[model samples]
Target: MNRLTLCAAALAATALGAPALARAEDGRWQIKLLGSGVLPDGRIDGVKTDLIGLPAGSRTRADDNVVPTMAIEFYATPNLSIETICCLTQHKVDGAGALAGARIVDHVLILPATLTLKYHVDAGPIRPYVGLGPSLFVIMGEKPGATAKALGASRVTMSNELGLVLQGGVDIPVGDGGLGINFDAKKYFVDTIARFTTTAGVKALETRHKLDPWVISGGVYFSF
Candidate 1:
């Protein structure tokens, strides 16, 4: 079985073996440590300017990444909470469609700063929740790939922008001592401008891209 399948199986077995949650979650604070998967759609929305002469119907795709994530939450009420997460994910941008198999950018680092307001449902054992929030995609660093260097791109940069996040998750209580297993999913709607600069620090190309990503995570939580 794959690693993800193993993780899901282990989580299921643990949940079934544990006693059902009998009390409402009213902890004033909670924290989660998770392993997350970031899957992005880095398609070119529009080409503002292209000095590299991109082919017709050319598209770009960002590779998926796995990273460690941490979240801190404050419970304002029994059913309401405020939460935020921290993580840095890395991806590679590659050409698709007409320019398939071409690597355009490499080692792009993204730090997703996110905050959400969550509402928990009063399920019998599994605590289900939904949340919405704002996020900022901070592009820390980017390097030009082989293809970009061949096209005379000496530098690469992606704009940092604000976005929205829609979230959903379930918390399965593992024990009575404020411990649980959390599986969360967040959808991000964001975009950015990718600039390819020449050796003289002049912009050679600029393209608007859609960076919508679905971040899925699984982890253990502790309430205090």
Candidate 2:
């Protein structure tokens, strides 16, 4: 089976045998295993370039990715907690407007780490929570695509990003243990700069990209 299927099956089995797992109490720790699909609503702006044949008004955009994710939570009280979430995701950059049908950058990996302070409602078997925090986005492993090479571009790099994160979710208890399912949604406001190098005697291209992505995820949570 694929990774998503396997994860879902494992969660199902865990829930079926929840009586054997440890329960959640005050000041307890919870860890989660999640499979997520990341959809980015990104836009590229301030695209200043001097490539010979490309238009000065050319624009860019980014594509989505699906990956596995993880999170950890520490409950300071029955209704309050601190949580950290992380994921390693890959994205592709494409040309837009005047540079349509061209691939500007490929196989770029982004690592986003987020920490939030959450307040949960004590609603017996079902708990709802809201959180707000900061995220650190690390951009790396960027490779120049065909369009870049055709324009004599040799290397590409993206600057590290910092953003704000807003989150909301619900948790439902399974059986008698603290094993349950958590469904979450998060919004991020991130901005970064991309630099591209050209041939030995040519100047580089620098552009700004804004990534305001909404991340939705569901997973199995174990508390102790």
Candidate 3:
């Protein structure tokens, strides 16, 4: 009777261990679809120009945007993963300080491509993770608004940027399968040059714009 009891215990352990092992090894790829709200929390400085119509010592502010974001994650191990994130967003630039209430820059599209190495802590149904990586900030589609054009500014141009990205987030598993909810915040540190053009004869106004933005996102994740 004791031998039969031991045999039953061993069979139960094997049955549970087999399923757990299979679950751990099967789902290595994950895709996340997120909605992100971008907030620019940096300053624009070093405004210099030869034009006379614009205000002296003027500064700028970047507007916010809510956009769709996506990421693909590959788990190299149970605790370590690599993820790539991308979102294309448009931000408006308005004058601050002396030039307040004036829209000098319009419809600037920012495309951020980031790659991160993440370390996750497994704590039952909720997993917390932190990541650090590099990002490429591609600035394009800049258009000068009416106020800028009237001030002899014919074009708005910004240089592309490369910077460091830091992120932290949590994942809450829904069921036994590989579906979960993810919430994260990311910070980008990038500095770029902005130049404003005038008529063909005048030298463009150049300034250093610090575009450090904080992005907060939340959405669904699926692993397969």
Q: What ordering of candidates by TM-score runs from best to worst? A: 1, 2, 3
Candidate 1 residues lying further than 4 Å off, grouped into runs, are: 1-27
Q: Lowest summed-lDDT stretch of 10 residues in model 1?
A: 15-24
Q: How far is candidate 2 from the true structure (C-alpha RMSD, Å)?
A: 6.9
Clashing pairs in 1: none
Model 3 segments more than 4 A misplaced: 1-27, 48-50, 53-57
**lDDT by residue for model 2 over 1-224, one digit each (tens)?**
45445434443433333222334444787888887778875567666664555575677788988789777777777887777777777898898888789888976877777778899998878999999988888787899889888877888888898899999999888977889999999999998888788768455787788877888899999988
**Model 2 CA lDDT for position 86:** 75
The 10-residue segment of model 2 with minimum total lDDT is 13-22
Candidate closest to the true structure, highest lDDT: 1
TM per candidate: 0.87, 0.84, 0.83
Error of 1 at 168 (Å): 0.3
The better candidate by TM-score, 1 or 2, is: 1
Compose the digit string of candidate 3's lDDT tens values, residues 29-94: 787889999997435756665455556656688999998777777776788877777777788888
Q: What is candidate 1's lDDT per residue for 1-224, written digit by digit as tens?
A: 54344334433443332122222354477878899999999999999888878899899999999987777777767788777777777899999999898889987888777878899999988989999988888885799999999888999999999999999999998879999999999999999999999999888899999999999999999988
Q: List the residue pairs that clash in candidate 2.
A: none
